[model samples]
Target: MTERTFDSATSGPIVLGLSLPVGSVRVQVIESLITARVVLHTDDSTGPAADAVNRARSEQNGQVFGIEVPDMPNGVIVRGDRGTVVQSVGNMSFVGGTVRINGRVVSGGMGNMPTVSPIEATVCLPAGSSFGLAGTSADAEVFGYVDRMEFRSVSGDLDADGVRQLTANTTSGDINVGRVTEQITAHSVSGDIEVRLYDGSAATLNTTSGDIEMQATGAASGHVSAHSISGDVRLAGARHLSVSADSVSSRIRR
Candidate 1:
């Protein structure tokens, strides 16, 4: 296990980016933190790959943004020499004023090299920070009082709460969002989407082959547009609003 911390007094929101082969990631906000922290926990397989696995480590922490697990070797032989199975569990990195995270595991060599263990990460950030998080084939859970947020994933579910403005895009992953103050734009392909909003908040939700559910509270005048191809669309609560819902073979319940 390796841990690193960064000290920064920048007065801007932090931005984060992450790339993982197969693992789960989480990001949270801390209010009283003045610095950022990153921890990496790795477990390597025994036998001939042990030494090579030990060499497969993350890059040094950067002042601005950092990524765990150095760049994969280009040649197949070079990659094989660096161990084909190194995994990170509970790998965490903390940042302030714009940060990004990126990671990926490669599988090579003959004869069962043991499935690449799923890598998980937990990121704690300061409140009121603007962030951007991205990953592939990994579920992500993010929350905190954020000014603006952008999230992208493929084949991984996403859940977010308490954000002012949000933009999310996913493929084959469910999306659940709560309490957006300004506006939200979410798009999904073959995955369900759920959104909750207050009065005077606008949203656009679309899905294909998945359900779309929305709930608005109070006498909201927000404009909501929801569309689905072969899935159900449902809207409940709130009066005095403009809503446009569409569906092909599924019911559009209001």
Candidate 2:
């Protein structure tokens, strides 16, 4: 278990390659720009990610090249690509077929104002990139696909045109998704949740203590379930939608 650091003129789009132990993997992304231009925090202490890191620094032509952390652990922050972050497969194979990244936090608009840039992470599995019960609860998981997704601190002004499939949980903030995969799950504790469905997308939303606003142009069989302790629920504009507002102060405007 070792560590290393680098200082480069990092900016723009970048990819993160991570390698962990034979267990689960967790990804926790944060933004607050004070540290440096870019930072790759690891969950595991596997000496130093030499080969992969050097390669990242080399091909970084200027516009903040991508990086691959050989052993990214839980709660480890991948500080770069102030844009979109993705979850994808690796060049090699995980020693274990099981991969989980639940109980994790994925966020943008960090480090600098409007931290949400154009960063995206692709998540795919190899053959049976299967898993049993990998927890995002500070465990080391690998890239095999995602079972659940959690979101935090998504500002209303952020433009999320490339967001596909997402599962989110927010606190004192706002969330908006333009596109969706097959299913999108979300819940908020103290803010409003807004989802704008693509032409033909499906989704599901749940919240407690906040409002739910959605827009769907296409025809998809989706539903929204909202419950609150002291907030209102709102929904509007969907070809097919079913919702349950459990709070007395919930509103829906779609």
Candidate 3:
């Protein structure tokens, strides 16, 4: 178990970035500090998972704080100034169950690949802070308010409360947001999306084989567009809004 803390009193609404593969993250919104506690669950204490946990690095460049775990090597370039990180995946490829970077084989085969251990991270940050998460099979839960949140994942579920803006893309993972004030754009291939919207909130939720459920509150005067290919779409408590809902081979209820 490793814990790292950063003081964000002077940074003022910092941006936190995380890249974790096969893990779970729980974020709590607090007052003024940012703390990240990580634990790697593995049987082998001297293996790659342990090494990756031991060698985890936290870098802060101005208002941007990034945590890097070597176990899942995603090409991320961090720039100094105000939290600018570029993820470059053009030179990476997976062929024949092997991982390659720049045409060089990193993992030879399924047997040669490093064992994937579940990493659990508990993060505490201030309110109004923004965050970006990149994960594979990693689930995340947030307990408080955030200014903006972005997630890109494969089979990773997300549950959050009170986000001003949110953009999430996942495959086979559900997204449930409690309160959306500004805007929300969520897409899932086979996962459900449920959100509660406030006044002047805009939402665009789409799913291929999962349900879309939305509840409007307090005037609900913004635009909402929901679509599902083979799943149900339900809208409740909505008044005075432009709504476009469609479903193919499924039910659309309002």
Candidate 4:
């Protein structure tokens, strides 16, 4: 018998702060807009969550946006929205589990914007947080803008489209993005980097020993570049591509 519950509030903002005693479960972040609203498909029905939901509902620590009992446990998806901002603070025993952002930002709605509106979502998993991409689809629309994003200690894949600016700092994980306007800066002491740009965007990828992959060519006038300590570089289907190999051990080609 799976147990679950939902406790939500209109904080005028969405902020989820999870602090509990003992439990083994996964958390997902999701967003909704338009007619095809987003839902949190959880496996746990409403048993294990009754206590937590009721307690939280009775508390006054912070504001709650939306809740789902039988929500998806593996990942939270923000669907059919124009300008929706999703964020989380991973504090469970699993630490900073995984985050999958597979949606688009529209305009003229509760969650809609043009250009990738700035993403102030800070998933600070410090010692146990991770992020990644679960799937890819053309169904996702790109109406709004992601102003900027700052990722820290995320242990999963980082995926997006039409990103204005982005920062990834993973102590142990990988970062993969697409369509960032200004820069895609990913620094991992131990991880890999992969950036595929459909529209030209500047990028700076650095890692200790993980390989770097950059594939973006849609009238992208920005320079394509990568940097690593003990990792190799690969480039394909690029226009006006330039090669500036630095290390004797590292290889660079156009």
lDDT of 2 at 115: 16
Q: lDDT by residue for model 1 over 19-54, one digit each (tens)? A: 544446677778885554433333434322233324
TM-score, per-candidate, Cα-based: 0.70, 0.39, 0.76, 0.45
lDDT of 3 by residue, 4-57 (tens): 343443445778888876567888888755443333343335554455567777
**Candidate 4, run of 10 with poorest lDDT:** 118-127
Q: Predictions ranked by lDDT, top down?
A: 3, 1, 4, 2
lDDT of 3 at 53: 64
Tally clashes: model 1: 10
Q: Which pairs of residues have clashing backbones in candidate 1?
A: 14-98, 15-98, 15-99, 16-99, 17-100, 17-101, 18-101, 19-102, 19-103, 58-69
Who is ahead in TM-score, 3 or 4?
Answer: 3
Query: 29-51 in candidate 4: lDDT tens per residue?
Result: 23332111122222333432332
Error of 4 at 104 (Å): 50
Error of 3 at 104 (Å): 16
Candidates in order have lDDT scores of 0.62, 0.38, 0.74, 0.41
| Candidate 2 lowest-lDDT run of ten | 128-137
Question: Candidate 3: lDDT of 138?
Answer: 68
